[model samples]
Target: MPVPKDNRPLRSPNEKGRYRRAWKESHGNLLLAFAGLIFLIGLAMIWASPPGTPEIDVDLGTVDSADQVVSLPPNVILIRVATSQLNSEGPIRIAVYDSPHTFGNPEQAIIKDSLVPIDGFVVWEIKLDFLPEQFAIAAYHDLDDNGELNRALFNAPVEPYGFSNNARSLVGPPTYEQTIMQRPTESTAIEIRVY
Candidate 1:
């Protein structure tokens, strides 16, 4: 019997197996190439966009004399922080948030400051002339100097922290409204005590 061109039979099973293997190999190579193209496009998009916002540093040096403090403009806000655990190591980090969305996010804070702990009170004089009329503050005693509010199991803070107006929360952190304060038209002082 003569075999038709479309119905040709393989001489051996090995020939049939080879045909299937070649088809599978070509499909595998096509899939790999498609995945690589997607990855390259994603990388190019990331490179074209700018990075996230940079942190704003609010350190303006220390004021040792009463004259220096008096010289500060009326827009200056004197933040007097009192911590019972003053003996703990590391600086006291403060973040000022102008909006509720940015609250608790130190990176999004309009103003950020860090102060060395003192025996009586650690003060931070921040000029808020450029800030909004209303803002909230979140401060933490970074005992580990790791620049983060270290937490243990159940998300309980290991270090002492406080908010403006000395706000307290039964569950988690205080809401932005609880800690919000009006910007003073003149030089004014506010206190925050960290537990």
Candidate 2:
């Protein structure tokens, strides 16, 4: 099917104002109330969610490096996210752990970068809802946008990446326990560092 063109001529400021105000007064409150209802319904739907939901919540306050919410609510425990605005130079590092090592990777990693418009350096939060027990969480930092990590031609990952618990990177990706965590009830903060 052909897509419709939204090329209708622009409206005058006065015309726009009148139409917007009328709609606002007529539908604003109703819209808000409807949105509230929907949010509540979403929470309620969790009651029917699968039995594998994992509960996770953490509070890191406001991190200066990057802003992210990693914890999950009770009903919807599992969540997924991606980081972006990385400096290909050396800033493409995400530390799920500060000491042991970091986890995740940027080699053609999806989300975050593609979804956002960036400048200088920035990390985006890609909020996803899932059962805590359904999927594993791996937050990777990509130094470059190429589909694969830098290799020495020997095919070893040339970038520094880590998993949830510094789970060693085997052949492909790590397993759930290797990178998964108990869902958080509150929001947790993770950072994207450069290499």
Top candidate on TM-score is 1
Name model 1 segments beyond 4 Å from true: 1-73
Model 2 CA deviation exceeding 4 Å by range: 1-60, 63-134, 169-173, 191-195
Highest lDDT among the candidates is held by which one?
1
- Alpha carbon lDDT of each predicted model: 0.77, 0.42
lDDT of 1 at 122: 79
Tens digits of per-residue lDDT, candidate 1, 104-144, equal 88899998988878773578877868668999989988888
CA RMSD (A), model 2? 21.7
**Clashing pairs counted in every model:** 0, 21
TM-score of 2: 0.35
* TM-score per candidate: 0.61, 0.35
Q: Against the hidden true structure, what lDDT does model 1 obtain?
A: 0.77
